[model samples]
Target: MNSLADPRVADLLARLHDEADAQRRLIRDRVASLADEAPGPEAWPHHMKDFYLPVSREQGRFLYQTVRATGARQVVEFGSSFGVSTIYLAAGLRDNGHGVVTGSEVVGEKAETARTNLAAAGLDGHVEIRTGDARTTLADPGGLVDLLLLDGGPGLYLDILQLLMPRLRVGAVVIADNITDSGAEPHPYARWVRDPDNGFVSNSITLKGGTEYSVWIGLP
Candidate 1:
């Protein structure tokens, strides 16, 4: 017995798979390089809750490209899990002459690890590591955010969204990671961003689970 599907569908699936694999390979290479330069095990104590799920190097490159393309000079991130994403954001900011990527990590150890990692990546100067709950840290961010990455607590996403909206620039970009889990959409963030009144044009792409990209449309 043979179970063959439509030729076109199969072809499309193959193409997508191939693309995904290529992206994975790229991300792997980047992560490996980062690992080589990362601080020793002594820095582990400062990390936040072991939520150090690093983004693929390809994803990091994609993020950097997005930030550079936007010409954003100020960036803010809600979670600095070992500074993996922070390095990527800082790389982009570095290329744009002068910019800062401020990140908050609730755990002191994790924040310290992030600091060490960013420093090893030669990005410490371009990135600021804040050790505390993101809610409190964001409450008084001293800069305008042209780009925001939400990788902190998904439960606090709505609250973070509300808090950061006012500080975002007119054409700011917000990227949220981990939107779905095992085929179940677990976070309300995507829904909130999709709401019409939110003034955010958002969509989810199936990359490393699922990532939501939302473009803020300024205040109403």
Candidate 2:
């Protein structure tokens, strides 16, 4: 049986992805519109505070599998965002029977909500939600990270990665979302990871938005 299909995981996802409701899609669109207006991540205030730009169901499942596949005992996520993505990562850790996920979110209320969501899923014990800018919160997360997920502001992806570089295990996997778009401003993160000399083998994966799957293959 697929690990995500577990009753605990299935029950939580159902609450987030209500396909029958059209309003959610509209809200998401409006949030995306606002996001497009931001000059850069630092100027991008907490416009998405009241809403959740969550990972699509497939991407959530992909996160679960990715963690499980890597046998990661420690995971770090930038942008917990109400914990929809956090739950996926923690679920994988739960199935592994050990491990912890440290999630950093810029908004305090969202971090609280994510904590509530994680508790409701019965995986709260395996996760930690740090409320503040990821750049500061993830500066020292207590241990080496086996997998890193960058789902925050696209502009901050590279910065977050750089901040966590020292703690990432050699084979760590870094997944970045929203890096692929046909716009005047492209995320510079793509170039850094795709370059073989930079110690990563990376490529874009087409999902609801777009996800960059990269593996850290450099020396410690």
Candidate 3:
């Protein structure tokens, strides 16, 4: 029942993860160069266009399991760079027998590349990659979202969450990446979701890039 174990998916994941590892130095250098001007999040897509910035194999597996466990029919992913994570999400849907992972990527080239990669994994049928700003591309998911993955620009995490909240089914899962505890303060997204007043019960878990797992409880 694990579509991720399929040879096509397993092989592609290995290659993508290896590629991401090789780009570590370039990513670090790019971030360091931005230390001076402190460019806004909008500048990140351009700077990171060429990088894989993929989720770790563990994180991808977690995503797959979450989808299967939840029986999620509608999943949305923000920041599907090159679709490494998208492949995992889509694989989950395929194994579940029905569902779709709607992904957004601002970089047009990355979106196309992601589509190709998904096809290579034999998962293109379970995903839709929308190439444009998530705010616009993800405006209407066409149905209630059963799960949402926030792996895009940190600054836009809250914005995108708010935008999609209305369409998120009660008890829906929300997984945010890069929510590390390296900072003295809790990340804004984590803070918002952890507050019961915000209608979510959330907790941060030790996983690749630090994962914030939350469930929508609806307003009290």
* Estimated TM-score for each candidate: 0.74, 0.88, 0.96
TM-score of 3: 0.96
State the displacement of the C-alpha of residue 217, model 1, in Å, after optimal TM-score superposition: 0.5
lDDT of 1 by residue, 92-147 (tens): 77776678898988788778978876775666778888888788887867777899
Instruction: Please tell me which model should have the higher lDDT, number 1 or number 3.
Output: 3
- Clashes by residue pair, model 3: none
lDDT of 2 by residue, 76-147 (tens): 999988888899999999888889999998888889989998998888989999988889999998888999
Model 1, 188: alpha-carbon shift in Å? 2.1
Kindly list the per-residue Cα lDDT of model 3 for residues 114-190, writing each as its tens digit. Answer: 99999999999999999999999999999999999999867798989999999999989999999875578888778
Which one wins on lDDT?
Answer: 3
**Candidate 1, pairs of clashing residues:** 27-57, 27-58, 45-109, 46-109, 46-110, 47-109, 47-110, 48-110
Tell me the alpha-carbon RMSD of every candidate: 12.6, 3.0, 1.3
